[model samples]
Target chain A: MATAVVARPVSRTQTRSREEEVLVWPDLVFIEFIAAMLFTITLFLLSFLVNAPLLDQANADVTPNPSKAPWYLLNLQELLLHMNAAMAGVIIPTIWLVIMGAFPYFDREQHGQGVWFGTEKAVRLTIVSAVVGFVGTWFLILWDSGKIAFFLHGWFGLSGGDSLRFLENVRSVQTQLPWPEWSRNITYSPVNIVIIGEDFQHLDFPAWLVEQGIPTMAMVGMSAMLIFSLWRVGWVVTRRDALIVLFSAFVAAYGVLTLTGTAFRGQGQELVFPWELKVSEGIPGQE
Target chain B: MTQMQPSAGAAARRIEHARQAEARKLSRRSFLRVSVFAGLTLSVGAMAAGFLGFFNLRKPTGFGGVITVVPARVPKAGEEPSRISEGKFWLSNLAGAQGDVAGVGGTGGILALYWKCPHLGCTVPWNPAFNGAAVNFPGIVGWFRCPCHGSTYSRAGIRVYGPAPRPMDTMAVSVNSDKSLNVNTGVITSGGPDNPLRAKPYSG
Candidate 1:
């Protein structure tokens, strides 16, 4: 027995492998339960702070000043103010969300992984385009609103002093314009049949036209840029096709927004020209 | 049996197998033993609190009562009634006559309906321009429209159009002898299409 004594040596790799611990299924469930409970309690507390029905009664005839929806819906309402409610409030949003949900299926790749851009370069580019489109839209709106204020207050006699004060007061509620007898007389005349509504039919346009030409051109330019960007992000098949579809879509959308601003906002007509300009920038017109 | 020689790998495998066997033999009796102890402790705590009537204040109990408002009559055929407010509620008395029985209350042919929609519980507004700006209904006939999902209801609390599943909720009303209105703030019964007081379908 004392003749032969042999011992096998331990390997460092084996020891290390044994030490590694992988999380099991139960651990994940516990974590998920904790997260859900925290989230629910947080929402319950926030509801109290915000005045909860959390509820309120809705009255349509007496529209609230700044007749805006809840904050999340404000974006949609804002769009409705510029574009047709059907388009801005319903169609575009539905299409946008559908397209977003479909993104993972169409671009199946594993390159970028956990990063914000995901794995596909094309997918990242598309994301950037969406961000740019959203931010561009908001930027254009602010620009248009500023330009509108300038043109209406400075160029057109319809918007200075008391008119602006009146406009501000009526911005949230539906307010009728204090149309002069002369304006009313011209409303029935056929000179501006293109502007059918009683409010826009009598707008004093020449006073604000020359300066407005710039914003008008800017609108066309911005619209062109949107087309180009959308095309670059794969909306169009070819350059020529991109040019045709984008220009057509922009014109049609702009026309719709302009019409909305013209009719719905008749009570606040002095702001019509600028309103159209803002409509060109994508703000929805509302009463 | 030949030499009784042992390998390190064999020894390690034997130890792991024994550990697994020990784990598999765990019994439901052991689990019950622990859970029963925990449950008993919780029950004891609850019983102690029960003995205390608990220092917690009892929730106040009361019967429903009326919230009153001045009388509002249907407006003259042409003029729209001014919007009236009673405490926390907003009243659009399109029927122009301002009578005494307006608040939570007694009736003078006054048709009062809560503005809140029964579907998803949103406040519905009367869009005079809903049937389009050209529609002649004006203020008298209009549906309560929910801005949230386009739920529409008639002034008589009936679901005329849109996604509303039932008629709007109605507050109890009582008109007193002094022409004052007493609206009992309780008794909100909202369900299905049938309403007790409505005479006919609201044309709006």
Candidate 2:
């Protein structure tokens, strides 16, 4: 602290001119200081009331069942279910980050600098998009659970008709079931979205297309479809308005995936009620 | 040095010339600084190169190379898989006659599955009780289940369930005269369309 000195004669502190310029120290930094103090006090009080969501001391041998990423990364962990590890854990996230990083360059709107929503329509669209995102993602999770179909038949004694066959029959699900739970039916019928009535019933699609490509495509396709549908309904007029829906949906989806990964996931990463979560993969010989 | 007072412009020109001369000549302090920087860079570069040169170093042959697993440690047909922690593999003796799995031969001999799951490298543990309703395959209990993403595989190391792209990778095996199993950890093969043959015919 004692090292603070006027090293230069023309330092920021020795400003001679007083143009209508906002100074950083008292104006911005003071606000930040007050905000930081408020945050620290709030956290202190919260810590007294609530326990930190950290695990017990880690062990080398016993791996926790459904070993989860931190809440922030759990969304990407959720992505692991439907794609190759390289694709899910790396490529897609990298692409997303690049897209998000480039967003400022693409989105150069002059207005609505300080406002939450650009327009009243944007506000309504944001809420609607959020709801759509939450429900749609929830529906997708349920669809992929391999449980919805199992439950409909197992619990309700329903045949394929009475079951949630619709989820299973989603052309992508029917075609590109990537996971082991998706059954070992993929190998027998390699890949290539499959156009019949020709000698070559299949086209070589670089294995990943079957594993990650379809699901990733579906995710992008669904978002595109949502945007297109919303646009057709006249709710979205400008590019920013459309972007509002997309961003809102993305944020809501991020929240939903995090919640799902944290709470609903169980042993073997299966979807289970929070109550049913048995922590470890279960020590090998103990069982 | 001139005794008479020089003009201002002439003095300034001389000073400029002197400054240029001063800039060109390397001082002892600057020389020391440069030598120190060079030494630091060379040593650091050498250390970094040494670190990377580890890959160029010949891989030692024994545990990581051709591992001659103990003969008695191998599992019998239709029994629990034997885990060779040192070799990073599991030896499963599948009984093909039970019709539990497809692609296995009639005898369903020993299959050495690399313990690392294809999903994300979490070591898959064999769950004997992971059977009946738990797995898609009915009546078949023994399975290699990856805890990471729940990528499960058959006793024959076939990708049965989970997010694994392919079946558990298998290492090349050759039997010795004394019946000691020699698993070449180096000679790896994917248990997919590339190499249809998964297991070597071993009673163990």
Best by TM-score: 2
True contacts kept of 1: 0.00
**lDDT, candidate 2, A227-252, per-residue tens:** 89888989887777777888899889
Once fitted onto the true fold, the runs of candidate 1 whose alpha carbons sit more than 4 angstroms away are A1-96, A99-287, B1-65, B69-108, B118-134, B138-168, B189-204
Alpha-carbon error at B141 in model 2, in Å? 3.2
lDDT, model 1, position A49: 90
Q: Report how far off residue A169 is in candidate 2 (Å).
A: 9.8
Question: What DockQ does every candidate get?
Answer: 0.03, 0.25
lDDT of 1 by residue, B1-204 (tens): 534455766888899999999899857898899899999999998899898876775543222445565444323222332222332122333232212111222122344466555544444554444432111122334445554444444444444333344456655555566555555545555533333242211112
* Model 2 lDDT tens row, B1-204: 364446766899999999999999999999999999999999999999999998795775754688887778887777888877667788776665532344334456666777777667787777677652231344677677666676667776766545776778888887677767988887777666322255567753
**In model 2, which runs have C-alpha deviations exceeding 4 angstroms?**
A1-62, A101-113, A157-206, A281-284, B1-62, B97-107, B131-136, B176-180, B193-196
Per-residue lDDT over A1-287 for candidate 1, one digit per residue giving the tens place of the 0 to 100 score: 57775776865654446448665767889899999999999999998798744123333333332233444444554454332234555776676577557755654545543455232343434444445444555444433233344445446644435334323221101112344535423444456555221234553332122123333444457656766666677654433333334334444444444443333222211123433432111111232
